[model samples]
Target: MAEDHPRLAEAQREHWQSTYGTHPGMYGAEPSDPAVHAAGVFRTAGATQVLELGAGHGRDALYFARRGFTVRATDFSPAGLEQLRAAARRQGVAARITTTEHDVRTPLPLPDASVDAVFAHMLLCMALSTAEIRSAVAEVRRVLRPGGTFVYTVRHTGDAHYGAGVAHGDDIYEHGGFAVHFFPRHLVDLLAEGWRLDEVHAFEEGALPRRLWRVTQTSPGGLGGS
Candidate 1:
């Protein structure tokens, strides 16, 4: 199993607490309105039991719950989970959510084929290595039933905003005092690991032209075949 990088995890905890936890609206360029889109998609698909990996501040969790889904939101950072719990209380949907502390680098504390849907936003990029990212995806698949959906978004490679002129050799990028390891894969590559790709929507964030790709997945046939 991949162990969490202590330094990177600690830095991420502090960064998220000071940024997204304190004022979630300012954490990213997008507003809460986009969550309406996500919620609508989930509702249309009739997803009731949801699991959110790397669920920061429970923004998506609260949105899904408000739309009548039971959500289990998990993150490695306690500080982030605290914010999520508080947000749930403030939204009057605390009863609909179950928050847990989880390290995505290892196996998740969930029964096999138990979850109906899994959501992840801006999580795959946070991983420091491709192996780690694949490990997390495997765990996501493990917790989800066959044909269950995985809704997620990720940063694409070599976008003019974040990756232009930035040399990312085998998944390492350094810029603006922040060193990030990015694993950019084609949609087919994601499907190679037993996930059936449903969609891939690509868009740029603001004027910076930073790209985001929304992808959806369904569980495969066997452990290594899908």
Candidate 2:
């Protein structure tokens, strides 16, 4: 059905841009629960640099910087990235953070094995197709060093909104002008094919209490061994 609507990703990008423009810093200044957990994981893994995808408004990015990790945060929305940059400046962590306006459907801008850890909050469940999501994971694998950790959250099929909204096929549905691809368990297992899956923890967020799975995986090979 996504083939029937080829502009879905482009349209979703526009919607996110407009949404962030209308509601600047909508998610507030606090880092998400996943981000807080990820910081501990990264520190244990001896990670000094972090790459965050879909870093809206830089809440988590700023947190990583505050934790003493050099961070590069990327998002598709320029408006959101601008807000993130402003926050980073105000927080006096601008030197430790960098912002990029990027879409996950494209390859990551970094070179192979560049980052020690990667974090993505609710990014894999965006308006992207299953194939695109897989490709994004591959890119993450490419950019991470050996034994690097990748933590990401995705709204799963268990979510209340899974079947609600206009169907776009591939489990993608549009509701309240937001498009989401609710992931199935099989997809998550498939994405972790090559990597060592560390954990899959269920959690809820927002007033609607959106259901999500926080997945942690490590790249192939032991730390610095690959």
Candidate 3:
């Protein structure tokens, strides 16, 4: 079965191009507070080789590159990647960053145990279903080396600020102009196949007035255990 909801995918692509593509630097310059704080965690991890899934506009990608990490950023949207490339060029860090067009529902175009760290911000919540989220988690596990860190953040299922007309039921929500689904399980459940959870924290985004959770884990061995 196809892993993406066609309508949601279309909405995402169009929205990103219209808003983010035209202003690639905006994402980095004025990132959400949670995003900015999350990036700091990655920087402090001291990873040398990093992979960023769903790297929209490449803000975090460029941020990591500026910190001296070799970063590979991937997203399903070509327009987003193009903007990221342009951003890299403008920052004079194009040589340090590699941008690839990739879908998280499929196997990542990377070798097993290839990267030292991985980050995904605001990517899991857009999956539209738990199965797609699991697929994405599987791929994240597939690409990281043992002890590699996986850091990610997502909308919390407990938020009460959902738009008017929003209905929520078991990890799924139908809301104004769109639908969103969240993995209701605690952070341990999202750990990649052989990874061990290191820390799990939750914070509320003041602007969105929404709750967000962040998790960090370390791969146990060379492969994702079943």
Candidate 4:
């Protein structure tokens, strides 16, 4: 289990850093559809600021910034963050975007109820354990303002590689030198505890048609902080 092995965790980080450093455009240059839809939803909700987790290469972060939202883009991989920073500068949205080195396993570096929206694309499934996912959700909730929006996507357990790789822990699998923690349907409930479950949709993307769940939830404004 990676949770039981410090070296395993470090290796996982190195793998991602290397992946980003080598390929650079691992996910491509275009912003994802879910991100665009989420930005519209946030706009509908009167949001002006967004906190994006695992903002690799800043496609979605730059998208949000270009759409007039102040975005805090975070990723644990320094190479990825640097790439995002460079993209933001080149896109002329550097003033609207802040790139940060952050790991979702730890507490967030923002204040409570500070952001109007939280967007995370396939980040929850990136080698995170169930406990870590719960902690990350808690942090997201804490950093969101009242009635804030939360939009995220994760690989569904029904994906083609669900059981193809070596088992790490729980639903986590190591395949092709990458670790992915596929999410079962029940995992959605873990994030819906203190928020309103607004949308849960089946989404597939990329050439492999990677199966995913696009979840959108909203934090209650008052008398709702459990």
Better of 1 and 3 by lDDT: 3
Off by over 4 Å in 2: none
User: How big is the positional error of residue 86 in model 1, measured in Å on the Cα after superposition?
Assistant: 1.2
lDDT of 1 by residue, 1-226 (tens): 1344556546655676666656654443222433556666666666678898878777777888888889999987677788778878878999999999987777999999887788887776763466667778888888887777787776767555355334444454545534455446653375445667777777656666556777776786532233
TM-score of 2: 0.98
Question: What's the ranking of the predictions by lDDT, best on top?
Answer: 2, 4, 3, 1
Q: Looking at model 4, which ten-residue stretch has the lowest summed lDDT?
A: 1-10
Q: Highest lDDT among the candidates is held by which one?
A: 2
Clash counts per candidate, in order, are 0, 0, 0, 0
State, as a TM-score between 0 and 1, how close model 4 is to the true structure: 0.95
Candidate 4, residues 1-226, lDDT tens digits: the string is 7545455567888999999999986777788999999989999999999999999888999999999999999999999989888888888999999988998989999999888999999999988888889999999999998889999999989898898878887788888988888999988987799789999999888777789999999988832233
In candidate 4, how many Å is residue 223 off? Answer: 13
* Cα error of candidate 4 at position 119, Å: 0.3
**Candidate 3 colliding pairs:** none
State the lDDT of candidate 3 residue by residue for 25-112, as single tens digits. Answer: 5555444554455556656655588888888877788877887788899988888888889878988999999999887767898887
Which residue pairs collide in model 4, if any? none
**Each candidate: RMSD:** 4.3, 0.9, 3.8, 2.2
Q: Which TM-score value belongs to model 1? A: 0.80
Q: List the residue pairs that clash in candidate 1.
A: none
Top candidate on TM-score is: 2
